[model samples]
Structures are given as structure tokens and as C-alpha cells.
Target: MELWFTEEHTKDVRFTIRVDEQIESVQSDFQKIDVFQTPEFGKVLVIDGYIMLTEKDEFVYHEMITHVPMSVNPNIKKILVIGAGDGGTVRELTRYNTVERIDMVEIDKMVVDVCVDHIPQTACKLSHEKVNLYFEDGLKFVKTKENEYDLIIVDSTDPVGPGMELFTVDFYENCFKALKEDGILVNQHESPYYAREAAAMQRAHEKIKKVFPVAKVYQAHIPTYGSGHWLFGFASKKYDPINHMDEEAWNKLLIKTKYYNSALHKGAFALPNYVLEMLEQNI
Candidate 1:
């Protein structure tokens, strides 16, 4: 018999992948964690039956989330990452030599430990000298800080379970307060292709727009994520992702990326008409 893993994207829809081997399975304080190996996606990390990342296409997500804001503001020295327990977000952020300090607050330390042992590709840089890992609630962590970080990335899961508070308006306000005067915030905005995900996406955008001077949504295609069309939220105090993007300066840095590029940076913000309509409905 063959073992396969399935994640229900909706009541009637499911995604199934063949599992080559089960590496580890544990019940953490927050969620169920599983690591598996597959022929196609390489190593896979699943949390609460949801596919978090795979070695094959993880670059698309980690790069898009980190590079977009970094390219927009090359001077981002201090960064706070919320809920990225897998450490892929931190790995990408570590590539920027200009970044001086990284404060990563992950609610579940088991996710980090499992990823470090089974998925080293994404978790390799979690121990970088500049990184300070905190196994605490990100919501309460942000509430205690003010005008400290130049960039804040909320690399959280779906707005459910431990991630629920991270999407609330109060959390967005706390993130806004935690940022410096010219700070930028990039977060995992839910997808717009499905009804449930679209509703969450709209609510997040509406709330962030109310708190930040500039708020925009950009997208990337991650095959494992629901509907293969994932969106990221970009909210800033002053800089605009497109207008402030220094293509020449970014290119001069000679950073090699698989998904994010200067051209894609501008094109990503071109939301589809239907997505635009959805956002407009909330406005």
C-alpha cells in the first residue's frame, strides 16, 4: 500500500501528494507537524495537514516575501519576522548584508526544530549571528515594541488557530506602531481565488489600508498553496513598492533569485480585474 497526504482546500476540494517517506511526526503545543519526502517536491513540511513549504518551489515564496520589500528599501537594517517558524523567510532575509539585526518571533518552536532537522534547505540560516529567535506569541511581542524595526514581515499561516490575532486590525495597528517612521510591512495575505480565502484577503487589506499611509497587494504563484495563486500584503509608512524600487541599485547587489525580479516587482502589483473588484467591494 502507498501512503499519500491530502489537504482539504475547501469542503469539496482536496490536494493529494504521494509520500515517498515519512520523516517525522509530532504533536506540538500549537499544531500537528509532519515532515515527509516526495519524489517531486523533495522535502515537504506540513502543519495541521496544510502544506507549508517544499524544497522545489519554496524559493518562490521566501524570495517574493523578502526581496520585494528589501528592494524597495535597500536601507532596511532591522527586521522583525512574525510566525515564520520554518525559517525560510529568515534565510532569505539573511542574504542581505545590509541587514544588521533580525528578531524572529515564532509561536511554535517545534516547527523550527523539525524544519532544522528534516528540512535544512529552508532552516539553514536560522542560526545566523544576526538572528534572535523568540519562541513567544508574535501578537504580544509587537505590542511591546515601538519605532524599533525598519521592516516587519508577518509570515504567518492562514488567519486561523494561532494565526488569528496576527490578522486582526489591532495587530496591524501594533505592527504599524512597532515600525520606524519610514518602515515597511509585508505580510502573507490570503488568496483571492476561493470564497473563504478571498474574504480573509479583503478583510486584511481593508484593515491594513486604514492603518498605513500606503497599502497594496502583490501576488505570486505557489503550486502547493490553495488555488496556486497566493497574495502578499505590502503596507508602508512612506515608500511605495513600485515607485521607490531602485532597479539599478537592486541589480547592482547581484542577488540571484529564482522568482522575484525587478520587472516582476512592478508586474506583481497589477491585480486582476476580479481581484480589484473584490478589494473595491470592501472599500
Candidate 2:
């Protein structure tokens, strides 16, 4: 089997895998879901045929997505996870005892069922008693909820198909409404190396900043994502990531981490000069 990942100029990525002679869709039950097994990366999870996460490097995505905001505020009791079907974010969220309730709103139940059945390594923590599974639209869920969470993590896939609404300004406003006074929000923003899509991410950062006072953009490295460089949208009411680094708590939280430690957490924010310039210009 020969596998190739190509970054299309259309701002959408495509991964092609040829097994033996011809390529056939392995898992196609879900409308836009595509699951594939890779030699190096283990199981690759995709939605609408867009690659979301791979087994080998999923820790980087999950850790940065879940830990960055959680470590900043050690008091996040109730958390809302939007669009994390594979349970990677749930796994990371469960690490902290303070996280009592996780309202996971994923529209596609098939993604959760498939991952629960197939990807035990990633989905193990979603089965925890603290999680409240909501098989409904995240947009609608956010609209109805109020002052329920200390942290809201937007773990949605690329802004397409079922996840398109998750990227809208209306959704961010609802996230602001659903959060407590000192609530914080983080979303898996796309890659910076990919210019057009990165521009879209920059616009997203702009849109989020409009609703959340302490909105900022951060970075992470995940091998499965294009360019291996990812962005995270940080939105908060009072907490600031730069001023609120809890070194002791961060160290304490790292005893069980493989992909995220104090060093990696610190290094994730060290962006290149050009990227920094872009963010500055956007700001």
C-alpha cells in the first residue's frame, strides 16, 4: 500500500491511499465520514473525507486543544465540547478532576459509535460517567444553553459539511452566552502554512475576538494535519494566557502526559516571525 497526502491549492486537503491494486472506501456508513488504516499513523479519522486525526499524532492535537485552556484556569468545572466525535478531547478533559461535566454535542452519532467500537485507544475516556452525550446540532445546543460551563472547547473538524456552522460568528456569540463570567473557549483552528485556509483562520480569529474579550490565536504541531502546524482560538472573559501561566499546576497536570508537558506547552506559543507578523497585522 502506498499512501500520499497532497495539499491542494483549493484550500481543501485530500489524502489518497492505494492498497494493493485499487482504492476503495473502507468505512462509509456516515455521510461524509471516511476511515482508513495507515502503516505509520494507525487509524486515520476523517469527516466528509477530510482527515481529522490520526492515531500516532492525535495526542498532539488532543493535548494542545484540551490542555492549553484547562491549564490556564485550574477551576474549569463544567466544560462543553463541540464536535469531538473521536473522544480525544474527552480523554484529555477527563484528566483533570475539576472537570465535572462534559457536554459533548456531536450531530453525527455514527462517528461516536464507530469510534467507541473501533478506536478504543482514543475513545476510552468518552465512556466516563461525567460526559453527557448530546446527539444534536451544536449551534442549537449553544443557543439554548446558559451559564453552564467554565470552559468551552470547539473541537470541530474543518469548516465544511456538518461542521460549517460551528465556525460562524453566531456560534461564537452563543458560546459566549453559554459560558460563566470567567469562562474560556478554545477551538482547533487550521494550519498557518496553508496560505488561503490560514487566511480563513485569521478571519476566524478576528470573528471570535469580536465576541470574546480576551481572544487570541495560538499554535501547535500535529503530524497528521497539513504542514503539521495548527492554530487554536483562545477566547475568554478575564483569564489571559500570557499572564496566567500556572507553572506548578501545569507541572502537576503533566505526570501522565506523553505528548504534552510543561516544555511543549510553553513551546507551542513560540511562533515564527512571519506568522507573528501576520497575527499582528490581523490584530
| Top candidate, metric TM-score | 1
The TM-score of candidate 1 is: 0.99
Off by over 4 Å in 2: 1-30, 281-283
Tell me the tens digit of each residue's lDDT in model 2 across 1-283: 3655433435465545432221223443435655666666777766655667778888888888888887889888999999899999998888888778999999888888878877777899887999999988899999998888899999887776677898899999999999999999999878778776687687777788889889777787776666777888788999887678686886776547767676666777778887777766653
Give the Cα error of residue 82 in candidate 1, in Å: 0.4
Q: Candidate 2: minimum summed lDDT over ten consecutive residues — where?
A: 17-26
In model 1, the worst 10-residue window by lDDT is 274-283
Clashing pairs in 2: 32-48
Clashing pairs in 1: none
* Model 1 Cα lDDT, one tens digit per residue, 164-275: 9999999999999999999999999989998899999999999999999999999999999989999999999999999999888889999999999999999999999999
Estimate the overall C-alpha local distance difference test score of candidate 2.
0.79
